[model samples]
Target: MNILHLSAVNNWGGGENQIELLCREFKEHYPEVKNQILCKKGKLFHKRLEKTNLKFLTASLAFQMDPRYIRRIISICKKENIDLIHIHDSTALSLAIIADNLADLPPMVFSKKTSFPIRNRKQSLYKYNHPKLKKIFCVSKKTRNVTSEGIQDENKLVTLYHGIDPELQRNLKPGLDLRNFLKIPSERKIIGNIANHIEAKDLQTLVKTANQLINRENRKDFHFVQIGGFEKPRTSSLLQEVKQFGLEEHFSFLGFRENAAALIPQFDISIITSESEGLPQFIYESFFHKIPVISTGVGGISEIITHKINGLLAQAHDHKKLCENILILAENEELIPKFAEISHQMVLQNFTSEIMMEKTLIEYKKILHERL
Candidate 1:
């Protein structure tokens, strides 16, 4: 079962991480099922792939529908005799659909990793509902539900949650002493967030939440640490807001740490202020580290985090409610361990990379069998 994974994005994030995880899983457990990746040249995903033993190819994507990039896809499919093409992002899907139209290509399986509603445009509708896409693996039920609206064949939409490798988490050691590096007092509880500086991440609300905690609530013992890529405009905007709110002392933005997950253990709590998500990888990593979480109940977050059971959840953009949840975890120390333990158990039982890959293999086989 030779599979070619496609990633058209230029940056590294949860979706990219899932591709790496899926490929690694196949390499270790199902060696017979070979996998290769074809990603945008000179990008973060391409760089990360270089560190791995997995087979991969790169193409120069100057534009969305670059002919050269499309030719590379067709050539690779023919040369590699790829049994299937697993598209990782919407851009890749668009490219794949074009390549399929020009030449005979293998069946495609797309991973819908975000809950963003599909655009109602004719092109968008045609690309998603293209008959070549045999399966659409949604990262969460909410993603699947949202995707169903744009897709014609509902059977293709499958809810397949992405997960972390617990073994890797268990063995992961902190690459840096965050408290020492950030010069945070030992007495101060660290509130950590791992997300890129993007509009969907709602980093503005994160700043507002931090302001409420430090200035409004007058809580000086809590420090907020954000770790992710420093996307322009958003990063500058967030910095200005942090400075404007006089939160420089309370907030630390450690832009794009490669070892971000390793720092989870140092966090007293984990937070996600995203207005939209398929489900961030930070939540699963936090579960493995036994770190309590406070997040917005957007996308598929509620599927894993039952409010007040395993974690606290607030509505999107509601900084006051987010602050209240944070205070709840901080003041009630007993609830901290309680929530962490429950979440830890949840990840072990259902949300591990091994479990995810096993289910994925089943789906892959089913798809292949149907073709036969």
Candidate 2:
């Protein structure tokens, strides 16, 4: 089957990672399944695709409503004879909505990777409820629940958790030991967060949590190391907050590293302070590396974190609760490896790339058959 996967997002985040994984496995599982990726040129996503053999087209999105951009997508779809178009971001979906009105487009499926609710508006309705969009694959049940409420056809929405290949980042020797590079004392414990400086990531609560940890006499030794790139304005604001909280020494912001995955082994524990997520990619990667995850219980996170079972959960934006969870895991050293094992086994059994690709192919086939 011919499939066209499209993502207009310039940054390479969890959704892009999932798309790349899907493309890689699509090639391996069905060599005959023709796949194409259309993404922005000179972006992180394009850089990741340079080594892959998957067919891809690159373009820049000056504006979302640009008819030229829509034409570019339609032209590629026509040339590739794409049977179906899988949209990964809202920008692509929006353009597809406009493009569909101007041309006879192929069936489209959108992957809703975030748990944010869709606005009940004409624009949201056109992008989601349009006739061309055949399916809405949500990364978490929470995302599906929130998204289905705004849409007319609840049957079009499906929960498909994001998965990872356990061995994908194995054997890559990172040139930099993050702890050593950061000049953090060898004996101090490290709490690592791998997310960009976005509002949804909720770094404000993370800063507050760090302050709370420092206030605890025994928890002062723990260092929170985050590796993410952000715009200067956001960075400045975050730095200002850290200074205000007197957490300058306790918090370390290691701006965007391409090989951030390689540094997970250095962390004592992995934490995600996001207010919303469609089951974050970092959690799966951290679990694969045998690092126990502590995250805010929001969106699809509850589905993956079984409350003190595989991993621990804190209420979103509740830094006090987050600090409490952190102390529980750190103080009880025995629970670290135990939690890691449970999470690792969980991902291996249910959230692996192999399982994701298999299920996706089944969906693709089922959709095509129904259309026929």
Candidate 3:
């Protein structure tokens, strides 16, 4: 089968990462399954695709809609004789919806990566675009619910969780090299948060949590390390909050690093304070590295973590609860092994890349059979 996968950005965020992983494994598993990527030309991720056999097609379908871009996609589909077109983002969906309407156009599928509001104003887009789609793959139960409610065909909406390579989670080398590289003091008990510095992430909670640790005795034993960048305006506010709370010495922000699994193993615990999320790969990555997690009760997090089991969960935007959980983990070394065991089992049982590929291939074959 020939597949055309579409995405709008070049940034290596969660959705892009998911598409890349799928493309890589699909090519490996089915050598006969030729694949092409449709994305903005000359973006940062283009450089990262050098070694892959997948070909890329650049078109004008800007991240948002452009009528001319829809014409371009339809032309490419006809010229390339693509068997199926899989669009990966909301903007791409609009263009693909139109492109699929032309004569001899290929089957189209869409992956829903985010949860939609119950009364989403974007429902009109879904109503118009979803009918043209052969199937909709949602990243979590929440995503599935939103798509099912938006589209007329409940059968077309399927839940396929995000998967990661088991090997990527292995810490082949100790993180001491990274520690020395960052000049992190060797004696402090490190707690790491690996996410971008965005408003949704509520990073100031981490900074304030560090300050809370400082007021207690044995304060020198604990410290905070984060892996993310702040290009947006709110980063300035987060920086000011950290400074105002007197947490400069205890907190370190190690701007976006790819070697997260290696770095995570060195920390005592991993924390996530997101206001919302789908099933995040970070938790699985931490599980692979055998670290415990402290996260908020959001999205599909409960699907993986049982409170006081695999990881601890806090209420959204509750900085005090976040501080309380961090202190609990810091004081009790015994809980670490139990948490790690449960987490590792969770990854092994449900989130492997192999399982995701198997399920995806089945979906493709099922759709093909129905059309035949």
Candidate 4:
């Protein structure tokens, strides 16, 4: 089975990480099923793919509906004999649909990695409900449920939780020392977050939460460390807010670190302040690292994290509640290990790359078999 994966995004994030993980899994365990990737040229995903052994092609996407990009997709499908096209993002799906119209291409599968509601527009509905797309693999149950509203054929929406590779997690060496890098004292507890400066991440709330903990609550022993890309407008706004709140010393933003998961070991507690998600990879990574988490109960987060069981939960934008949760972990350090152990066991039992890929392969085979 030859599969071509398409990613239209220009930056590196959790969704991009999943594509790499899926392809790596296929290469190591299911070598019989050959996989290749086609991504936007001159972008971060293309650049990152250069370091890996994965077979890939790049096309210049000058605009959303670039005719040149569509032609390139058609040419590759014919040249490579691609059995299926796994579209990784919404833009890629649009490009694929256009290519399909111009030529009879292979069936397509889309991975809905976010829980954002599909826009109620004619074009959006047409692209999402297009008959060429055989399956829509949602990252979490919440994602699947949200997607079902937009999709005409409910059968295509499948909830497939992407997970961490235990072996990879164990092998990853600690890359950054938070204390040394930030010049923070060893006595200060590190609260770490792995997310880009995007609207969905609600980094403003993160800044507010930090302010509550540091300035309002007068907790001088806690520091916030964020690792992700510095997107424009949002990053600038977040920095200003942090400054305005006098959180300069309390907060540190490490822009876009490769293998950022390695730094999780340095965190006393992990956090996700997203207003929306399809279950961030950081959650699974934190679970594997045995780092207790405090996150907003949005998207599929509540599906995995039982409030006060494996982790603490807060409503989106509720910085006050988030501040309280942080204090809970800091005051009672014993709960840290307890939550970590339970979360770690959960990852081992239900969430692993092996399980995720196996299920994916089953779906792939089923689709191919039905086509045959």
Candidate 5:
């Protein structure tokens, strides 16, 4: 099937990474599926996609709606003879909807990557109150609930957990030299947070939780290493917040690392303190590396970290519970293996790129069958 996968960004965040990985898998596993990606020109992901059958088209969008860009996208879709439009974010979805109308289009699907409340209630209503959308491929149930609440096409929403290339992840096994690169001691117990410094990610909660551990005279050896970037304007306050808390000495903000999976093994524990998320791809990466995670219960996080099984979960925004979980993981070594085993099994069984691609193909075929 001919397809156009759309995304506005080319940066290295969870959503961007997810799109890149999906494109890569589509190219590798489904060669018959001719696909192109519509994106802003000259971005990192746009450049990276040069290596695939997925052709790249440039279309600038303002937030989730821009008429001029949508017109351009529609013209391109018609010229390319596209059969499916799969959007990775809202901005792309806006353009896709316009293109669909113009080209007498095929099926359209949006990959639900985040729980939608972050978009103000008014904006959410304006953007999602559509019936033409064929399906929503939610990466988690939490994301599905949020989208279903705002969208009229409840039956079209399908919960499909995000997936990664198990082989690629397995090849990048965790090791100790990552600590050496960070100038951290080989023996210091490390707690890592791999999230962009955004309000939705709750970096403040992560830092506060770290401080709570630091305040404990008994747990001074625990270190906090944050692995993400602040390229976006919304996250400008995080650097100042880190300084305000006097966490400069104990906290390591490594910006964005391309080889994050390689570094996962160096840290003794991983944490996700997001205010919202879909099923975070990092959770699967952590399990792939056999590193246990302690995350706040939000979005579809609970779908992966099944409390006391794969990893620990605390209530969202609750720094005390975060502190408690971190300390418990730090103190008890036996609990680590149990969590790792369960998580590894869970990811291998349910969340591999192979499974995701198969399901996505099925969805595409189903949509086409309905049109026929």
Candidate 6:
């Protein structure tokens, strides 16, 4: 079967990682199943695709309804004999739906990776519940639940947790020394977060909590490191927030480090304060490194953290509780290893790339068999 994967996002993030991981695994295990990607030209995904052998086509899509891009998809579908279309992001989903309308295309599936509820209003609803969309692969149960509100056919939504390559991160050597470079003292406890600067990440809460911990509590023993690229046009806003909150001494923004995963082991504790999420890739990577997580109990995070069992959790936007949880993890040395051990084993058992690829292939076969 020939599958055409579509992604329109310019930034490289978890969704892009999912595409690369899935396609690579699928190719290795199922060489008979041909896969191709249609991505935005000159974008991060397109650049990364060059590193892989997977066939890809790119266009500078002006918007979701760009007629030229629709025609391009139609052309690719005919040339590649694409049997299935897997839409990976919002713009790509919209483009695929439009392309389907323009031509009698193959069955399409959409991957829902965000836990933010789709606005149940008419147009947004149509985008999600379009007739051409055969299935919606959700990364988390919370994402499925939120998407179900905008979807009429409940059976279409399937919760398939995003899986990481267990072997890829295992035995990863420390690629870089972030601590010494930043001039942070060895005695200072390091708290780390890996997320692209986005609204849903709610990094303001992290800054507020840092302010409370550093300034209000007079806890100068902790250093925070955030590693990710800034969202376009919103880069300096975060710095402004840090300045206003008086967290400059405590917080360090490491912009778009290529070896961010390698440095996770250097952190004393890992944290996430996302207002909304499907399931973050950092948590899984941290699991492989045996780094304890302290995240806001949002999205499918609870499914992993288990509130002080495997890792600690706090409510989103609640700076007080986030601070409390961070301190508890920082101060309790015995609890760290226990939490890290359980979390690490959880990912190894349930969330490996092999398991995810095999299960997803089964679903694809089921859908294609029914269609054929």
Q: What TM-score against the true fold does each predicted structure earn?
A: 0.99, 0.97, 0.89, 0.98, 0.91, 0.96
- Model 5 segments beyond 4 Å from truth? 51-54, 61-68, 101-103, 117-131, 173-176, 231-236
The Cα local distance difference test for each model comes to 0.92, 0.86, 0.74, 0.92, 0.77, 0.86
Per-residue CA lDDT of model 6 for 1-372, tens digit only, reads: 999998888788888888888988989999888888888889778888897788788988776677777888899999888889999988887787778887899988888999988886876788788877889999988888888888899999998988888776765676678778888888799999999998999888888889988988788999999998888656588789888987877899998765468899899889899999999999999888899998999998987779879998888899888889888876788998899899888998998887878888887898899897
Task: Indicate the TM-score of model 6.
Answer: 0.96
As for TM-score, the candidate ahead, 3 or 4, is 4
TM-score of candidate 4 relative to the true fold? 0.98
Tell me how far candidate 1 lies from the true structure as C-alpha RMSD in angstroms. 0.8
What C-alpha lDDT, on a 0 to 100 scale, does residue 107 get in candidate 5? 68
Q: What clash pairs does model 5 have?
A: none
Query: Which tens-of-lDDT digit does each residue in 200-228 have in candidate 2?
Result: 99988888889888875447778999888
**Candidate 4, overall lDDT?**
0.92
lDDT of 3 by residue, 3-88 (tens): 88887764556676677778778877886877788777676456556545667767654546666667778777777777788888
Regions of candidate 2 where Cα sits further than 4 Å from its true position? 216-218
- 7-101: candidate 1 lDDT, tens digit per residue: 89988998899999998899999999999999999999999989889999999998988887789999999998888999999999999999999
lDDT of 4 at 210: 97
Q: Once model 3 is optimally superposed onto the true structure by TM-score, how far is the C-alpha of residue 178 displaced, in angstroms? A: 3.5
* Pairs in clash, predicted candidate 4: none
